[model samples]
Target: MQSTQLSPRYRGLRLTALAAVASMLAACGSGGDDNGNGGKPNTKPAYIGAVTISSYDGATDDLLTAGLGKDGLASSTAPLPLNPAAPTAAELRRYAIYTNYRAIVDTSAGGGYGSLYGPNVDAQGNITASEGKVAGVEYVAYSDDGSGQQNVTMLVQIPTTFNTTQPCLITATSSGSRGVYGAIGTGEWGLKRGCAVAYTDKGTGAAPHDLDTDTVALIDGTRTTRAAAGKNAHFAAPAGATSLAEFTAANPHRLAFKHAHSQRNPEKDWGKFTLQAVEFALWAINDRFGAVSANGTRQRTLDQDKVLVIASSVSNGGGAAVAAAEQDAGGLIDGVAVAEPNLNMPPNTGIVVRRGAAQVAASGLTLYDYTTTANLLQHCAGRATALTQAPFYTNPTMAPFFAARCQTLAEKGLVTGANTDQQSASALQALRAAGWEAESDDLHPSLAAFDVAAAISVTYANAYARASVTDRLCGYSFAATLTDLKPAAIAPAPLASMYATGNGIPPQAPVQLINDRDPQHGPYLNLPSVSASTQRADINYDGASCLRNLLTGSDAAALALQAGQGLTLRNGNLRGKPALIVHGRSDALLPVNHTSRPYLGLNRQQEGVTSKLSYVEVENAQHFDAFIGVVPGYSNRYVPLHVYLNRALDAVYDNLTAGRALPPSQVVRTTPRGGTFNTPAPALLPSNVPPFAATPAPGNAITVTANTVQVPD
Candidate 1:
């Protein structure tokens, strides 16, 4: 690890900048004459709305841990708000930090929380007993147009230890559809290195508009009526051709998530939002540290030339970082480091991905294409004998549903089989043919049990189609469900704390995916609802198939969705910025074949010899680090991908700051901390998760030639 200390020259420059800022403030306070030009103060960016600034002392309240510190973060339970009915903005902020932090990171001691990576672990990888509490000032605002319809939240955290002379910035675009704090775990890497971390929700957040209650969330996670919030609302259901009152009356208890119903096709602007976040961070930093000019306007003390900026995050946020790098026409981004990015490859790229001598069956498919397919087949696939050892596979209660799904698939000719057993095998094979690797076999059962595929498919399909909440695209509606699995009004407490707890996508706690087309049982939860076509509890097969058909269907709605998917596709040109991408080979949700592998080929095709992208595929590591500690058998079979993500960040930072050679593209074979199933695995050690090598062994090297990416088998 590189030293965090500033050199003598940098220290002197920091002192000079501080002195200049002090002199300028004193002059302004004394109403002194302008040094040169007319007296004018620095102006905030036009896109930025009312800024909210708060300071933390690193004791009672702090940025990284939200006053909980390292120990508090390691606890199994999060601190709750004093008033469940209504949480204060401060309480919501703290809860957001805590929830988002644990969402990405494995907090269990056996999962390497304190040892490999955590608040207590320094950038230098040293284990410290001290609670890692960073004293910093937080600046938050909405990066919006005049309409406020696209009020993408942007936040900047500048730790007191930030080096003024050798300035650095890191972008942490929110992963998945989470709120601004979604990538807080990734931001910790930059914070520990004394770099300013810029975060954006990328136009998708956890602020669900309760259509029934006429309420919406604000930028600060506080709730208010849509009429009261006015242009300040984070998200408000557009009236469209019908009024809100009419829509609510017709679709009572239905909720509208910004990602699914904003009708903005927000994914298309993820990169723009991420770049805007960097701009916001730069402006905030300049506002604080820049020296006043002759006209009393704060001069640009830090910029692209003076500051080193790295685009980084994970999952959807990671994808946003890559997108930002591709769209960085202004040269704002210096490098990129991310893990398991949700990349959507352009059509007809002619980029082939191969493992050893065999070409991948399917590659470069969009998120909706693969996710909807998974939603259709994963339940049936979970019953395959190959996945018998998978977690959640042996539950007797779910077995009938899995069997029913296989029967339905077979009857529909989606799979050819004589019995449920054979149908399951066919379904599992279908998933592999669709791009999933054998390593992903064990993950399907648990992922299916959690409705991961259904939630993603429904959300993405609605988003791509730009459908309204009232449309309930594919007959799927998000709402609270009663004991009988029927739609019900959401409780006030959950609605109030949703901004801090909801993971944007529905089927989250307190919000269930309701099957509106279930004729046998009106508007019931998807899992227990009987499919209208099959008349069986096949996990809402009708809805899943409908979502899948959007890719190939030629209807107007399908055409619109296809158009929106096109707008989100990446050109893969990084403009020559050095970048590092690490993805788990066992990532079932966003398979490596469809994402990073093909993305590497696409980048090479676009940039050719000038491309500085390196891909690291880690074996035995999957998406969702939180699962490693909580899900049975996950800890014994899979290592935390978060460790490798940090390593990649470190490597990228070293390459930028010290001109160190970035690690070569390779397959990092990691060993899982194996133990008895359902029992906690042994404490993680360095050997369990090895670092990517600068010069990987011959068998592990990943090679790209003529826009063809080949990974070692």
Candidate 2:
């Protein structure tokens, strides 16, 4: 559905980014140090030119490959080419460029550099400068809205100096704005002769913050000269709001409030103009790139080749829209890598893949919300940091705030609240029985909705709440409406397909990455947890900026991958780049014993041409302490970018983007086994890889070529 709702910030941001070109960007990270000046640029002469499919006939391509599955794609990279398409600067500028990586925590510099300089790391192990491009770094943001997201493409460029192209290798990154396919593959340290590289989110924040340089000026500009924009930047604060979510969370206040004097009068904020723009960046090579053959080479949409997609569990939020847009998108997609997918269809309901709350309120879904709720009554009732006195999740002083939210939603029929229960003793008792503990669990859409619904209902029914029964249910201050998870069957189409999400990643997925070690959080390591698995912080880190954030935020694992410790497909054909690591057997997160297919579809489209892959997981490392947390002493096997960059680029060149095979990352006893989380032991590796060679790539691109072996039919 088209939304008339618009966030004026969007307009302000675009104009701001455009204006920023002339202005200096704000310095960030480690007092603004390490902007790629230290590393020597790889000046080696090599093949560099691009070749793209431009476009392909979907009827001819998709129809033929849709049913071919994985086997067909694995073997097609036998011959390939090397060329670099010179996309105009204007064309490239439209992409959301990762301007810079900075750090934002602790004793200074930025986290991006902490591994080499600060208190963030003690060992500063020889991860290698190449592997650690920008770890613990915060990304500088720049948005480009023109990248045609509906189409999959493989752009390859070879160095002009090197004309002869035989087995070349390449690697690439996928822009989150689009989708990720053929993520970086393994097999480097020399393999695949013609390898290339590509790199995304490079920043840390909610919904790719300051996406445009203009946003800074747009916002800062509005602060100074709104008259120039002619009030186009004149947006209102939430009517009766006293503070921004940021402000409210910082300063204590009562959680409950009536919607008074809305800034837009009756209109609501519809979120960032994501519907208009999305960003993504990646490198593709090898068979993943256009295939290099004796007769030259060819490129195709990623879907035309055999590839697998790294599920955007943190970003796509179960891409209900992807499904809705599928037919309309035609050949745009093939297989799907949906991590912790919401599979909302009624058909997907009964099995209970994973269940969380729906339609959470602003007061309970974000640290901002819960913190606001915690503070809402504090100052009003004369208390400071009241919730801090107890486990914030179980604070007693904040009960009234929770009561407020519950009552408000109940009268509106959005939920069953204090008055709920025609049958179950008193509604208040029912809430208590439902696990009301005064503290907020807004960490996820699952728990947050239930918490906020209760809070809002309580606040509205208060003798003084400035609300009405007739207020529109469409208010955007928070997630008001949500899917009912009771015994009721999920509705098909619209209901199950509704474009909305609530809390965090389904569950086990988070723990899979965290991999705890203790039973005191007991059964740590391999299992998922409430804190580490949060979706709000992963995909959306707009709340704060800290290099430590990259490690703790949602998608923490995706952002902090150590070599040998990542999610991997059981089959050898797949690639994992910008790799998001997960442990296998994560019942609380992704479905067990199954390989997702988002990338495979892209591969089919590209006719088995892609140079990268993104997700890698260990076998059976579910919420048991085999992934993340405080375990110490042992070096995290999760390959830091420094160590990974060298080998990854090599793999991308020969194996990933190029469609060859390179050496796999070495799996070692890396993760710790105590403290908080334990790392999964020796990451899983594919057994069916073809006979491969460590062929180098043309120039500086990554490369890989797997050992030749028969792919299963």
Question: Could you give candidate 2's per-residue lDDT for residues 459-502 as a string of tens digits?
Answer: 21211122221221111111111122111112221111111110
**Cα displacement (Å) at residue 136, model 2:** 19
Q: Per-residue lDDT of 493-524 in model 1, one digit per residue for the tens?
A: 98999999989998889999999999898889
Q: What are the RMSD figures for all models against the true structure?
A: 3.4, 22.0
Q: Give the range of the ten consecutive residues with the poorest summed lDDT in model 2.
A: 98-107
Number of backbone collisions per candidate = 0, 258
- In Å, residue 302's CA in model 2 sits off its true spot by 11
Clashing pairs in 1: none
- Give the distance in Å from residue 212's predicted Cα in candidate 2 to where it truly belongs: 20
Global local distance difference test of model 1: 0.88
Each prediction's Cα lDDT score? 0.88, 0.21
| Total colliding residue pairs, candidate 2 | 258
